[model samples]
Target: MTYDLVVIGAGPAGMSAAIKAAKAGAHVAIIDENPVSGGKLLGQLYHEPDSGWWVGRNIAREMIAKASSLGVAIFRKMEIWGIFPKWNIMLNNGERLTTEHVLIATGAAEKAIPVEGWTKPGVMAIGAAQTLTNFHRVKPGKKVVIIGVDPLSLSVAQELKMAGVEVAGIYPPPATEVSSDKSNPKQIIQGLSAMAHLAPNALLKAAGKAANHPTIKNIAAKCYPSFGVKVWGIPLHLRKTITAIEGEKQVEQVRITAIDGNGNQKNGRTKTMGVDCVCISGGLYPLSELAEAAGCDFVYIEELGGHVPLHSPELETTKDGIYVAGNITGIEGAKVAMAQGELAGTAISSRLGLLQKGSDAISEAQVKVQDARANAVITFQQHIESGREKLAQCWHTNVQTSSGKG
Candidate 1:
């Protein structure tokens, strides 16, 4: 089939982009591997201080409704195997899609910490727990031990607790070759120190801010409360590690121990807590394989969640007629992904010569992207602002080099 624009994800970003382009008179079609369009939005349930409860599935339904009403084609349960030159997307079902423009909003994948006994049935990635509890309304287990302490794990832990699941504790991951820096106690403090603004009280807030200093980070790691500090009545064990998950067929218990500033287990007092489930969070990274196969330039920016496609502020990838948005561009929340989708839609419409006020519309959309960033709920990386600036610089340099060659 042929379309003016084909979007490769049905998440918030892809659906919103389709709505934008379709409204601007561009024929659009969107595809996804899931039976529904919500993507990870289906698993998101959180209560912000100001925003109240954010039920992401509800928001996703609204977007899907708007896009379907706008005549944008929706292809559900479809997977794209690859992208070819001059805009051809090959679906895994043996169908080929030809398009004038392509947008890769494939979103992100959860990184996992492979601890001992992780292959057990009850052990899963933090995302799987979120999906089972929030999306499917199925309890993962009676008692759960979560490994890793970041925004996603923390938010999901809160949700699991609200769902009546016994949250044993939220502990840091084991320091392995894959992610030693993140697993280290001091490194985690340096990263989380940037989130001090989200601290509830003056005391914890001050502690978070103070942990930013190298000397203070070491002190904080060593002096962390043995029982852990309660945030929302859930124990966040910042200086502890889950060494092994033990079970015959499913997760039964976790071997946990206290760690010093280096994350090495302290001598004595290795306790085993019974937990029917274990959720491991190794953070997230951009899913950019589609972009790479499509011949776009890439750069690794840790702040942006690993390697991402080199794109402009307007979401244009280096490859002509190819665009990217949402987490595929960089890791942010659903709100920012939706804003970037809107921006991408506007940019694609303008390039197609369908928008009469294209420049003005693009400029307006850029402000929305910035505003979305300011109000983002879960900030995975502390230095997102710097990551974006670096991305923009890379884009401009590539553009100049191409122009020179021509």
Candidate 2:
């Protein structure tokens, strides 16, 4: 069947895009591989720290309800294998779909961090642990140790703790460095500077102003790289690295080596921690295979979760009639994805004269999207705007290249 807009991936982005387009009178449909919607949002459960309450669960429910109310058709458990220009989508179930405009909101997957015995039975990605505990109500393990120091890892560790799982502690992953990898003390200071926002408003303001300064930046981060041990009740060990997961059947214990401030392992410094589960999380990257297959141009922006499709402020890809949103565009969380999805849907609907009332729909939607982005706390792409701009310029200069070519 042909649709005016066919959105792939039914996550926060896809659902929001379909709802917007359908509200604008376009025949919209959303397809996803999962039997349910919400994507990573379903697995997510945490206090926003800023908001001071646990969210994600009710938000996903509300979004699904709104999409259904808008007459947006949802097709679940349909895995899309290929996407062709003119919006021809082939599915693994031998079903085919056609659309005038396609929005690839396939989102992202967890980045794996391989270590010794990572393939053990109880070892899994932090995302998998989240899915089990939050979605299925199945505790991943009685006790666990999380590997990685990123915000996502920290947040998920908190969730696991709330789920009655004993979280031993959090440690840094093995850094991937080369001879050419220059150590930038400023990077560490910048991260610390950012973390200062978690402090009181007076400190946050001071840190923001001092972040660009060299010496003051270090002073700002003096108390940072520190977790709320009292709140989560989990130790934060930034100086340790997991060397191996030792077990014959399942995860029995993890071996860790002490590291210097430079992230190099200190000679003969090691310890073992017993745990039934080891949740490894390096980070996240966009799942842009469908976008690449559809011939959309991608720019390698590591901050945005590797190669994301090159798009404008309105979320339209370089290719005509194709758009991308959510983590597929970058690894920003659900709020940004929903806003971007709304923008894409509004843009396409306006171009096709699908607006219910008049041209006002487009303008109104644009304003809302802008507000959503401006107010978001987890705006990943904007957080590294300079890096994004540099990557975009680099991609533009080398237009002949395609992602996955290497």
Candidate 3:
């Protein structure tokens, strides 16, 4: 069927854009590969610490409902394997639906870490762990050790804790040496104070309130490390390397060694940590392949987690009738993705002459979307910068090791 707009993926971006375009009197059609339309939002757990803003599924549901109200056509389980420069899309399910405008919202794929024994049954990526627990309702293991210390990994830890699994301490990769001369006393104090205010509430309510009780206060004071010059008031553990994982069919123990400044494992110094499963959280890479295929210009921005297409404030790509939104542009949260979706929809609507572009009608919608984008940029910058060095190190090591194996 010919349409005014054809949205691919049916995730937060595609669904939102479709609904907006349909409401504006455009004949919109959305195609999704999955049986459902909600995308990753449906598979994410509620209790993950940083996953508080997962409105994508809710937005998708609402968008679908609105689109149905507007008589937009939705094709579920339809996979588009190819896109032409003329905006003609090839679907695997033997259907050819052409549109005047196309919006690609196919999101990113998870990258796997290249380590020995990583292909074993018990080793999984953090996203896979989340999907297993949240969607499949299957616990990978009762005891789990998470590698990497970031909001995403921490969220997994919180989920596992709520699932009644024992979470071993998070292990960050070795940090570069801090220069003694450049250390600021005021900055250090501020950091410590922030951690002190934040740490107590990290625990369950009963555990947090028990610290005030006379008996538990003494125990908490003794067990918890003092807030000091450490990183986040928690000591940064330096390690040489994770040597090997040992078990028959499932993981049982992890081998680690202390490393020097150069990352060399100290000889004859090894330690073992017992855990049933290992989860690795490296970082996210932007999925911009489809945007690139649509003739959009891309710039390599390390802070945005790899190559991102150049898009206007209105979320329009270089292509005249094409738009992009959500994590496909950059690795931001679901809230920002939803807002970007709305922005793209409005811009597309204005471009098609279906909605008035500058009649003071779309100004409020534009402002809200721009504000969300600005805030997302600020919050993601810190994470993107801090994560770069570690991710680079891992990437180089993985490439070298994988090449040798090949």
Candidate 4:
């Protein structure tokens, strides 16, 4: 049976859009690759106490229940491999879905820093580490070194500490200013302060002592100016780059050397650190491949990562009858994602005649969604600009090797 709307993700955005459309009397289907329905939100580490953004979880869960009540079909463990021009989706599990309307909300992927030995078994991204501790209840390692200084990295460190794992220290990559454009300075500062309060210096020092054991002497605390006051007492080191990773069965030691701003290694200035796990957090990238393939027009905005497709206030992409929402559009917290999802849902309902067009209710809802989207854009722009130089450097090297070949 052809569906009125087929959403290509079960995360907050897809779920929200599907529920709204289904409740409006449309035949709806939601598809996801994971065994369970919830996306990264469910698997994320719960380090900070109830931040407002986390409300998306409950909202998404409610939408799922509502959709089920409305007879909406939810398909789990079904991966969509391709999308045709006519909006026909090919699922890996031998199912083909055709829908009159399509919404892409596949979400974003975590980016990894290209450092020597980063591909080794002990090296993992911050997101991977969160999946281990939060979802599987498994600690990534007894002694761990985190390589970023954002709220996400800080949250990972706190969660690791709570799980009885020793965080050797947080090694921020470099000193970069927080972007004023993309951040709600007041709220971000408050969150950072609270994260700092959770793990005081005394606590980090104790963990350092435990990690400094002869067997684990490779662990050390190094600081970069970019990490700010939140990450104090970790041994401070600068202008260093990883040279090589050494170990037989598992990660045992890493060789690093000082380097100038020009990416040149300093002569005879090298150091080694012993550690079992290296968690890197470069940042996130927009997973807009499906959106792009669906004929959405993209513009390279420096503050929004790269190649963010232009979309209407309702999250509708340039392609008529197609929409984009959530992290697939840009990187923002879960709260902003939920707001976008709701807005898209309402717009779809109006377009399909399920809801009256341009009514007072729809107008009010649109305003709220637009405001949230505006704020999120500003915050995300700041983050992208803050790391623009490093990101550009990495992108240049990546392009030289990948050659625009996916």
Q: TM-score winner among the candidates?
A: 1
Top-lDDT candidate index: 1
* lDDT of candidate 3 over 1-406, digit per residue (tens): 6888888777777777788778888888888888877676755444223445443356556767887888878888887777776678778977787776888787666555555566677888887787677656678677776655444565566666666667665553332242211122211122222222224244323333553465654353233332211232232232334556677887887776564433444688878888788887666777777777777766666666677666655666657677777777777666566676777777777777888653353566667655765444113333343443444444456457757999
Expressed as tens digits, the lDDT of each residue in 290-387 for candidate 1 is 89998898998888989999998789888888899999888889999999999999999999999999999999999999999998767877789999
Each prediction's total of clashing residue pairs, residues at least 3 apart in sequence or on different chains, is: 0, 0, 2, 5
**Model 3: residues >4 Å from true position, as ranges?**
45-60, 173-241, 259-265, 357-363, 373-406
For lDDT, candidate 1 versus 3, the one ahead is 1
**lDDT ranking, high to low:** 1, 2, 4, 3
Q: Global lDDT of each model?
A: 0.87, 0.74, 0.61, 0.64
Instruction: Report the lDDT tens digits of candidate 2 across residue range 187-301.
Output: 4334434444343245334645676786776554343443413325777565567889999888999998866545566789887888999998766789998888889877887
Superposed model 4: Cα runs more than 4 Å off: 45-63, 173-243, 256-267, 357-362, 370-406
Clash pairs, model 3 backbone = 240-258, 240-259
Measured on C-alpha atoms, candidate 4 has an lDDT of 0.64
TM-score on alpha carbons, each prediction: 0.96, 0.85, 0.73, 0.74
Could you give candidate 4's per-residue lDDT for residues 292-386 as a string of tens digits? 87777675655565666566656677677788777777776665666667677777777778886535545666676557654431133344434
Which of 3 and 4 is the better model by lDDT?
4
